[model samples]
Target: MTLRVRDLDPENPADLDGITAVLRAAVPPMLVTPELLWWQSARAPAAQCHRLLLAEDEEGRVIGRGSTGLAHESPEPGLAFCNVYVHPEHEGRGAGTALVSAAEEYLASIGARTAFSWVLDGERNLGFARRSGWSPSRSARFQRLDLTAPLRPLAPPPPGVELRPATAFADDPRPLFLLDAEATADEPSDVGTELDDYEEWLATSWGHPLLDRDLTTVALVDGVPAAFSIAHTDGADRYSSGMTGTARAHRGRGLAKLAKHDSLSRARAAGLTEAYTSNDTENAPMLAINEWFGYVPAVTEVRHAKPLG
Candidate 1:
């Protein structure tokens, strides 16, 4: 009847699989894999104090997991984060509490002044954060579309723009990386991140295990990447938009829409049927683009923040 939290070892077959299993059991809709998990752990920034911890039962079965990391790259400092989840079947035990406590202690030790976590916006989930002193913040909605559904045909690219696959830039992904940095700096988030490290960007974003280069579409304006839709596929029937964004200068020209539409079409052509994306409720431009693509709101996740002394 003992419950304890311990650091996760990505190299350990049992630990890695068990962690991914717990995540899948707790949040089935999100895509996670042992390989992707390990890759992230390997390439994470050292200053971030990023750690993935596992909660194990008496029999050595990992039933819960949590991820905590410092926002090292964010322009706003002192922000750390943790999101703990337990298998529904294993709830009511002390695993959740143990993991959360461990996470808070780790972040505090690293001088994190504030912590942010996403707790599903529901009575039960919100109740947990509230009881723990966390307050509600902004909310986001998850949307899904059936790739098999009839989609509004995307009009041909504008005069000087053309659709290009991310794979085409395998020899040189720096352009896409730059575009990603510019777009992400503006995305709605509790944390403000500005990507500045090229190597880190290559390791974390361009070389991610789940990112499907061929399925990712970029809109090139006169040979420069102006907008892009990053895609991740499960190699099965599902695909998701990791991010879709356009540079500031490219706004109002339907470039983000064009890139995403092109990526969705490519995903469907690749035999993926279900596609999903998430958007902050206030991001009208992205929300509108998703709607145009037939993506309907499937779930909503609320962001919860708590300041620690």
Candidate 2:
């Protein structure tokens, strides 16, 4: 069957559903929806040159999807990402190769000097990356919790500390922004990111379509935002932790763990059946916290990079 890759039309409902289907099939634990895909494609920062590409067969069925864009927030310049996911049923049909080639061509056209992709840790995936001239760099773990199962009870905030939902700061999210920026900078990754753009963060993260402000818990120390567990729900049973971190000054205080427990409790009470989260292998603190919460290993993916010349 002849295959072709093309840019997705975010405004097209069929395209949105098609891509969402492929993504859900490829990464089941991810909290993704048609709306989230639309928001990512439409509201992506222009500097990133983000493109959601779709691979279709001659029969016009979507068999693969690719999300490619520059790492504009990285301190290092000209770094780009091209993550391609082909529907499992369509694997080995050349869809993955076609999508990757199209994504690389686009990245290079936009002045990218290097490209990075996350390959699910497996012989087939690793072999594909190697044959495509990409080498493994780092690995991250995806974890899942059966929210329907009993969860650790939420602990009362210690004296001088208070827990609040992220929506409480809707009037002014700058405090949460500051905490997120600090935590994000310290996250382990191949491409280091610096969240220096407040307006950009507000647009991309604060106002994201899937951000469940009510489920996102934040801990305040003496009325100062010290730790937070950002939550994203698919407006259904699926929920995922977008980011969970504590300010540098509040480390070892158990604030991050507290925030996550409260957030998970809220999610479970609100009928979210499953909770998913990911952590870089180097992020021991977060990993430990997840394990303590009864999240079991789900899958692992290795970051692979290739030079663009």
Candidate 3:
């Protein structure tokens, strides 16, 4: 019963099914499909440096998987991530450790100075990471909203801001991309990310399949994009907010709330009955906005960091 780690080909349907199963088992609250998995791997920026590795048992079943690479946009270089997941039923079979070892070696080969991972908050999960030289650093919560239930009527757009759909930028989306990059930098997190490569951004984010351009809401202020709430759907009732953020300069104006409300209203109208989103526990402002929109915490995941020797 040997375990081996190898690259996962997005073009292969079997790879996607295996990866999706691991994702669902590891993080059941987060929705995933073949389309979403392929889109994510296929569109990763070749320059920013992304890699997805899968662990297979002797029988050729994927028992674990990891995504390892450097976040080039981050101001700090060598910042890499690798989350290894072993199916709950197959824990302690050496698959998880083997997966992490492969991911770490790959990241180190790519000049990664630090490796980050998200571990499901629990005794066994945390203990595994600790034994492997990883330490808890930060935490985040996943929340879900019942879109089918009655929701508070969203207020009209403010005096100078207008609620608009992201589809409006289809003709030219560079502006929205720039806004997304800017807003992401201000987000509270243990791993600070900076979006520097435009082309990679186009491939990884702009080219995502689940991104619902029509349902994403952007708040415009005098022709400028101040805030936005991005939505991703799985062609069914499940919907997720990729991000909802307001520009630093426009933080006090409640544009994030306005944008998110518009997004939720549009999502409900579009037949999405369930909405899920995650937020850093320290991001009080964003959490408040989500709570206002009827989002309730569903799960907690902890960020773990391991310093290389």
Best by lDDT: 2
Q: 24-89 in candidate 2: lDDT tens per residue?
A: 898887778999899999999999999999999999999999999999999999999999998888
TM-score of each predicted structure versus truth? 0.96, 0.99, 0.95
Model 2 CA lDDT for position 72: 98
lDDT of each: 0.88, 0.93, 0.85
lDDT for model 3: 0.85
- Please, what are the lDDT tens digits per residue for candidate 1 over residues 63-85? 99899998888888899898998
Q: lDDT (0-100) at residue 181 of candidate 3?
A: 89
Cα lDDT tens digits, model 3, 1-309, are 798889888999998899889888888778789777776677776655777888889999987878877766678877888888878877889988888898888888878888889998889999999999998988999999999987787668768888889889888888888899899988987778777667667777777788888889999998889899999988888889999988878988889888888888888988889999999999999888889888998989899888764
Look at candidate 1 and tell me the lDDT of residue 20.
85
**TM-score of candidate 2 versus the correct structure, residues matched by position:** 0.99
* Collision pairs in model 1: none
Please name the candidate that would achieve the greatest TM-score relative to the true structure: 2
